[model samples]
Target: MRENLAPVSSQNMAFTDCTKPTDLSTEKKRKNWRNRIGFLLKTNSSESTLHIMKNRSCRPTADDVNQWAQSLDTLLSHKYGKAAFCVFLKSEFCEENIEFWTACEDFRTHTSHKELVSKANSMYEEFIKSEAPKEINLDFHTKNAIVQSLHEPTATSFQSAQRKVYSLMENNSYPRFIHSDLYKELCDAARREGKHIKS
Candidate 1:
């Protein structure tokens, strides 16, 4: 059985310890945030979505792309880098890390309690829950911390979980992304653009 199992990364944990959340005081709040986080805001006929970022089609310059190599923070801070990395992760089916991280980034901007609670519970269901649709690999302690925070649903509710996921991406996903063909294509495009600029 062990041989059949894939090697686990940092956040990907055995979820035999799944449990229910404690703080969602009302059933309404639970249902609202029960929505799954999606990678595509793809149109079939009618599709209204939020939190799912449209992949920025904008290109980055060679210098800008090169900056990403310096650190995970640099890559994430640059809009194109963020978009490109999101694409890369989507290819790997681990877009949840970036999705969760970005969701948390968006989470902090809300000042109203209603907005905070709403987004917090949604994120909890989408990523933190043991069987979440976009379930992210999280440890027991970190998972518990976020679960506890969700009861009150503050802007910082998912901060620790976000940081943990960020670390996982920085260590695991970012390195692979840097080497990925998708990134290489961006670099190639940047190089071509640089040559075009010179001539």
Candidate 2:
């Protein structure tokens, strides 16, 4: 008989190296960077066009964002309006208002009928539905209008509802966001870092 083979035990086989545990802070930073890149890609073309418009400038300084915070009208009227509002809202725990508003904005940009229908349905399900995770506060009339519009999706189908939510945030949430300690901290941090107002 030939020599016998050895048993496949740890002593016989080579051991594989173990990977080090991941740093949660590093992972979080990586995720944040990825999200930032994704947002930039989504708004790249639109932002480029707006960049050329002096009044709608996309590159805002810290002071500009601070100034925008002084009035809800000024903040929402900016080309990158959601940029600052979203950051502020996140801190105040009222981010759904801006998220729904921005989703409506993106919904209106779809040119294809199929895409319009798809996005409209998702938007309605997510924000207009009574118990949706991100359900928006809407009046009965506005909610009914969205229900009727779902049959034939159009660019402006969500306009009325969007306007209502915009008004709600502007009147109710904006004042608190502007004066919150988070706002002051953001401005202070920006001043120290010498970075543009990105949120």
- lDDT winner: 1
Clashing pairs in 2: none
TM-score of 1: 0.70
Cα lDDT tens digits, model 1, 4-122, are 23234323563321222455343533233222212221222333222212222444678888899889999999987887777666555578889988999999999988888888899
TM-score of each: 0.70, 0.62
**Tens-digit lDDT track for model 2 on 7-106?**
2221232121112235535455344434543322223366643542333234444676577677877877665445756764554445777888889889
lDDT, model 2, position 108: 81
lDDT, candidate 1, equals: 0.67
* Model 1 regions lying over 4 Å from their true place: 1-58
Alpha carbon lDDT of each predicted model: 0.67, 0.62
